[model samples]
Target: KDFKSEEEKREYMLYLDGSNSWILKPLNFIYNLNDKAFFLNSDHTFEDAGTTIEIIRRAFENSKNIRKSDVNSKAILIKEFVDEKNAKKIKEEKEKYLKLSAKFSCNDLHLELKNEDCQKFSKDSIMQLIMIYAQYKTYGKFNSVYEAVDMREYEFGRTECVRPLSVEAVDFVKLLDKFEDKQEIQDALEIANNEHKNRIKSAKKAQGVDRHLFGLKQMIQKADDKTKKDALEFFNSMGYEKLSQNFISTTCTGTLDFIGYLLFTPVVWEGLGVTYLKTNDEVIYLISYHEKQKENAKNFAKYLNEGVEKFKKIYS
Candidate 1:
């Protein structure tokens, strides 16, 4: 072994070529160390991926005292008995969410609303109103809209759910145009605030319109053929559910005060993504669509800024 010099041992290895490799065995589990990557399971439901993760975290990690036995149970929130009415509603909403799948892209917007302005107009309600306004200004109308609700306040199972708010937002936007005075603006804000609060209350108790509708869908699915057919027919007749995205989904996420650098990237390598995150001093809005829709996303950012500034001036 010592017959040749050290230089001769390396003679066959010229330039340390990385061109050759051989596999001796395979491994079962996979490990990924790349921080730049994100993922969404192909089998997941149509709910926004970011919201889904936050929901799981709240139900399991945040709430330490949740009942382990109720892990997989569904709520009988409204009309415990399954009927044609409930099935139709669920099918209609579910169909709307599924049919409106767009492309994948992303944009981050940084903005600040002072504490004083937030007192007069609720942040959630105002942000929601602004979205509707921007959509109307751009697309003229949106048949259906989505608002993700947190249902963790109730003493239920560990699995969390979101309430899909089906509202006449286009009609509401029309009403906004008729407001000529401060009284009218105040009235509008009041009504929107009330609706927002009511949605949250209903969602917490499991009586949320969407959650109940979901329960109904499950019940009707287990029923006879005639029932299922009837529900489908009724759902199809509703034009609102059929109309795809003139609008998109929205949600508000929490942030830390001390952490200077933070990343809340969720995997949406294929479709759309949107999330609202806030620290003590600022709010960051992230919206994403497919690469081809970059122009639309850019315009939306402009619309959002204009909407916010206008709202600020209206009641100022």
Candidate 2:
């Protein structure tokens, strides 16, 4: 309900102070009709001091909601005066509070209408100022304004921080070996073919080309020298050689890390040697960077050790 007058406002203030619903308590004491103001007028309650009958009586006269019958039940809650002018100041401050709240609301709507660009958001705008003012008003503690701003900022920060996952080095080899099993190899090949076909279809539809070779080439060009060197080293470590000419390299999308996975496929096969090579029969390792999937690497290594222990599998 709207605070219509000074007494109504005072009642609301008392209500806020006495209630524990808000994060911070607002009032410290309750006064009755007749009491000498003590300790900023908040040192004693009506129960502790019997002399508050007059003050309560005046408050009741000014308040419309204070029924003659309920006066005995609801005594006035009092708080320490930050200053004698505080009640009047708070009364006046309500005007500014309402204005700020309204402006903040408008700002929220405007920001939503505008393009979603953090850099473009006005630094001194009402929305930004409202958040800052709210923080200052609450002194870093809980308040309605502060809580609202915190939630908005938290969501924006989370969106900005989110990124796609990327594969790591150790599992690169294990994925290849996993495909060595006939059934697993067949399933992996099907998945790879599906992906390849989808990509080819997308590329052809978009650019009228069966092979998006130009796009892959652009990715190879965009790669930093360090990334290229690291990629070559990774490939060599897996017994794969760099293509004499990076033919399909010019066309690619997505992050360099994802592209690196695609690029690493040939290297894995090459590193294993010419004996494993087949014409037009490419292999794609089903690699995941999921932390949980890494347990499979340990299991695979254990299986390799067991096989060697049983058959004494010789190294080349």
- lDDT of all predictions, in order shown? 0.50, 0.27
lDDT of 2 by residue, 92-166 (tens): 666564443232100000112112221232211212222222222223221111000101123322111100011
> How far out, in Å, is residue 87 in model 2?
89
- Per-candidate TM-scores read 0.59, 0.15
Clashes of each: 4, 30
Residues 173-195, model 1: lDDT tens digits:
55565546766666666666667
Candidate 2's C-alpha runs over 4 A off are 1-174, 207-316
Model 1's alpha-carbon lDDT is: 0.50
Cα-based RMSD of the predictions, in order? 16.5, 30.5
